[model samples]
Target: MDRMMMSDLLKTIFSVLLVLVVIIVSRNFIKILKMAVDGLISTEAILSILGLKIVLASAAFIVPAVFVSVLMVLGRMYRDQEMSALSSAGAGVGRLYIAVFKTIIPVVFAAAWMALYVSPWAASKVERIIFEEKQNIGVRAIAEGKFSEYNKGNLIFYVEKITTDNVMHDVFVQDKRENKVGIVTAEKAEVRTINNDLYIVFINGERVQGNAGEVDFVLETFAEYAMRLDSSTEIQENPITGIDTTKLLQTQDLKELSELHHRLSVPFSIIVLAIMAVPLAQVSPRSGVYGNLAAAFLIYFSFANFEKVSGSWMVNGEIPVWLGFWGVYFLAVLFIVILLVRLYGLAWVILQLKGKLV
Candidate 1:
């Protein structure tokens, strides 16, 4: 009978926590995307990007949200004397641990799956979509009479007209180089792809090149002149999500290993946090139902920051990977256990004091 009541209470707590997480995460996602749109991304494209980003961000935040939620609920219960009632009815503060674990164990497993598998898959898909969309944006903008700038404003191109045959007419190109300005006027132009390079082929054009106050040199082009506009930038491969779990295991790089540990820790941290929340939630009767929420948030973040620092240290070889990854979590568990014991011991001492005084 007690088990059933505890289960019902936990369900109510979980539901409230889930709702709070969704609202907070959604608001954050919208704010971030609005900033991106204002910064030059097309509204339509930003909407698509926002959708992809919010899902991944929300998934990542689940464990932390759960930790905060549990703390809040338990703190309220304690402040309201519900926990005192339970204790008087032969339930110890430690019993709350069992009830919390029942809900948190499965949540931790789910978080682990998301961090290990689902997050990476989502990241890859988002990248592919963004890449493809960005590649076509300039071409689409040109058709609508928009001036397109690329290569950090070194190149400016405009197309007055485009046909169904993929042919462009009345093209103007400007190239800016050190002490040199080149302007090319073409009667017609067409985009062509060769060896993975995009070239604008100009037909019957004239080029003028010189400094602002120097004699300019002019050249006339007849049949075809191709201008290469694409420059390759160095791309650093990310280990976090672009690679699969199997690949992560194969790579022996410290950074990759650190990331691997970080991913695996997310789910495990949920269980530790749930255990920790049970005792941390205790509050004085006069403190009100929300009394311990601020403290709980601080403690949760402190533990999270410790884990992050440990991961960084592991990557730098300042600590052993396995030990560094688990050390913070172990410390957190120890701290929680001590706190739980103290809370129970304090309660028992207070009862004896009251009995003697009475």
Candidate 2:
């Protein structure tokens, strides 16, 4: 009977965690879809990124949300006197932790897998997808009135306004494609596709062309100007966020070290948070289960946010790599100690403290 009851409890907690993950993933999907609709991203890119986004986002929240699920389940049980009944029936509150940790171990490993491997892989895919789209689709990938790099800094474009009919006004473009640089300023422009190719058509523009190394330079006024969108433009650097764990481990650069530690911290944190939640999840019989939910979220978010801050500090060389993640772990351990003391008794805690001191 105890085994069955504990099984059901674990199942309920997992079910709740699943729902929360789905809700989080769905909200992110809607946000990304809106970007697609607004032409900020291509339809093909959106479709390709959707699954990866869900996986990455879901992995991010799964471990943290586990605490909320456990809290709700345990809080409900305690609130309804189910825990009290089990206590009377020869089960200590400590017994509940046995079932809890059993359910969490597998989840902790899974979260670790995602944090260290799957999420980064997905991020790399998103970066690759966006890069490919920009290469194939050209300036159409950029919204009007924004500064955008054309071919990885070989060119840059800015527009003051874009009309409903897809016409642009007050255009500024820099051409660094060849040894001779050109700067073009136009009153109006149109991005057009001709013969299965993309071109920017500038009207009433002044073109300034020169090589600084030579004395020869030319400035010309044009009724119309056009430049082809080239595909050879490469992005400058791939970010540490998308790099593989093995590669990150091999590198000792500040940013990569920070990223590697951040990834490692995610899985380790599941154990920390799960421990904190076990005792904190206890609720009074007459009090609502959700009474502790807000506080739990607050604590969890504070911890998670601080992790990002520490990582930033690590990247900036404000702190050592060991300090970056270990400080957060210390805080978690401190929190768990406090929670355990509260769950047991102040008297027992003081006695234990004195014993340690002695």
Candidate 3:
């Protein structure tokens, strides 16, 4: 009975996990593609980012997927009267838990590894890839006969024609700075990297700098001039998700604390939710196969929202940092006790507890 039950649960978990991942990745794919088209990220990096995204998405949704899978698998058993058959054969709720946990124990460890380690690594890689791509914006943004804007619209670059050897003819650049604007036109130009900084090197160009329509405008002509585009010294502020778990452990930042708590919650949630699913999956055999799914979904979403709200509460100091999301987990466990009591009766629960204690 244990082997058979575990086999069904594993199959359901895989199917549910696959569906969740596809739905999530499809939604994110559009956003990633838009970033690539806007030149915020390079086209070549898209596939790499997408692969990493799948990993991140999988790790995240595995929690919900496992919960839903357990509910579905056991709910079906109830609906088909298999649970009744087992009960009549001297099996009980404790036996069911044993079978279910045979599958869940391994899953909890895997989810812990992914949440604590792999997810952060993937996030860091994605952030670094995007950062590196942005540094090459000077070369990536070039297109003949089109105007491109960069640096939050502080600079505009136009190339009338581009050649095979990466030379531009009739290039124009408009740079906007505080209280002044500079316009430059060149006969020939090319993007070049020097000293780890990107520059637009122009040959035989003239630059005009001053306020608009001002008589004090300054004009300078040069045989060759260079304008710095991007500096390597600019630091990229990585989000908390990208930080290594080991580094997160060394800090007491509320935001970072909340992130650490969030990562830990995944494995903890799997165990708690799996425990809840056993009793929650109980339904009248006549109630239909999907009867409990609606309620289970509502409970899952409520738990998810509570996680977010509690994380915010911790960050805002409304909740003790020590409590963190564990308070929410505690409430979930309490709800599970309530469910088990309702299903098996309070007297039976107490009797079982007493027996276990003995």
Candidate 4:
């Protein structure tokens, strides 16, 4: 690659990385700030979590952001006639691709590593830390007169009042276990931990239980009762994002297969965006560099959201695994090739020659 092209690519990549860090950090700071405001995390913990949040957030947006940044940077060069200088010197889009790809290769590698490994590790670590913190928090500040959900809404708790001494009054809990539903009401309750297990001890309470789909319900009254909470509510587990790729391949479960494909696609998307950005970066002579911003964003988000929807369908067996996540990516690649052939000078000539030959 020419020095000028390489230098340009490096400069643009550096600029893109800076913009990504700023935009992603600012956006996710709002979310982490809310956690601190709600007293779920301290200011110190928020600071710690900020780095992890950035990793997770960056993994999600990096592909699309790279596309837009590349478009703007390369588009600006073309707009300012810098690219024309190179073109007149006998350089083509292919040489431009060479220089850009040199820069993109390392970025794609880092992105793949983050998407496949670091992002999940960061997310999982944060989840475990938060889980432990909340567990230690231990119903200490149960909201009065408001229903609190636990274990993905499988368990619910409500307290009419909480005393200064940590005693709870008028406790109501609903437990939804597979095939069974239980509702318990008590005059008072308190949290107890035994050997790392949490329990809610109720006094003067009645319990009602029923099958999920049956009319028969059972009720019993007790002077005192204790119920253990086995739910840890881990945020990410067993999913392909958390599971090692090798381990994911050992299973044939549709959900897991779908997840594996989805996670695999995450890294693959970096390459896709890099390829797509080249031809898509070309702004018409009549339009400014920002003219294609809307189209670029629309194309990217549509691909991502559609892949998510298609992944869900694959998990549910509505679509076959072979044609799931890869299908969306294949379509993206096909679209990019079409655009390149139509817009990139030599590619267009080659396509026309092939058509004439046929």
Q: Which candidate gets the maximum lDDT versus the true structure?
A: 3
Instruction: Give the number of the best model, judged by TM-score.
Output: 3
In model 4, which runs have C-alpha deviations exceeding 4 angstroms? Answer: 138-240, 344-358
Candidate 1 C-alpha lDDT tens digits along 1-358: 2465356545755676567657766786677576455443445566675666656775677776777767776776777788878889988754776777776777777788888888777777666655544554554445536578866787788888888777888888898877578888888988777786667789988887877777666566667888875633534344366567678888888887877887788888887887787777777889865777787788878988898899888888899978778999889977975786587676774675588799
Stretches of candidate 3 off by over 4 Å are 144-229, 232-234
- What are the candidates' C-alpha RMSDs? 7.9, 9.6, 5.4, 10.2
Kindly provide the TM-score of model 3 when superposed on the true structure, using C-alpha atoms.
Answer: 0.79
Worst window of 10 by summed lDDT in candidate 3: 230-239
Which portions of model 1 show Cα errors greater than 4 Å?
A: 1-43, 145-239, 346-358
Ranking of candidates on TM-score, top first: 3, 2, 1, 4
Clash-forming residue pairs, model 3: none
lDDT of 3 by residue, 1-358 (tens): 9999899999999999999999999998999999998978877898999999999999999999999999999998998899999999999999999999999899999999999999999998998888878788657777899998877788898999999888999999899987789999999998787887778899999999999667999899989999887544558878789889999899989999899999999999999999999999998888975868899999999999999998999999998986766788889988998998999999998999899999
Candidate 1: Cα lDDT at 187:
81
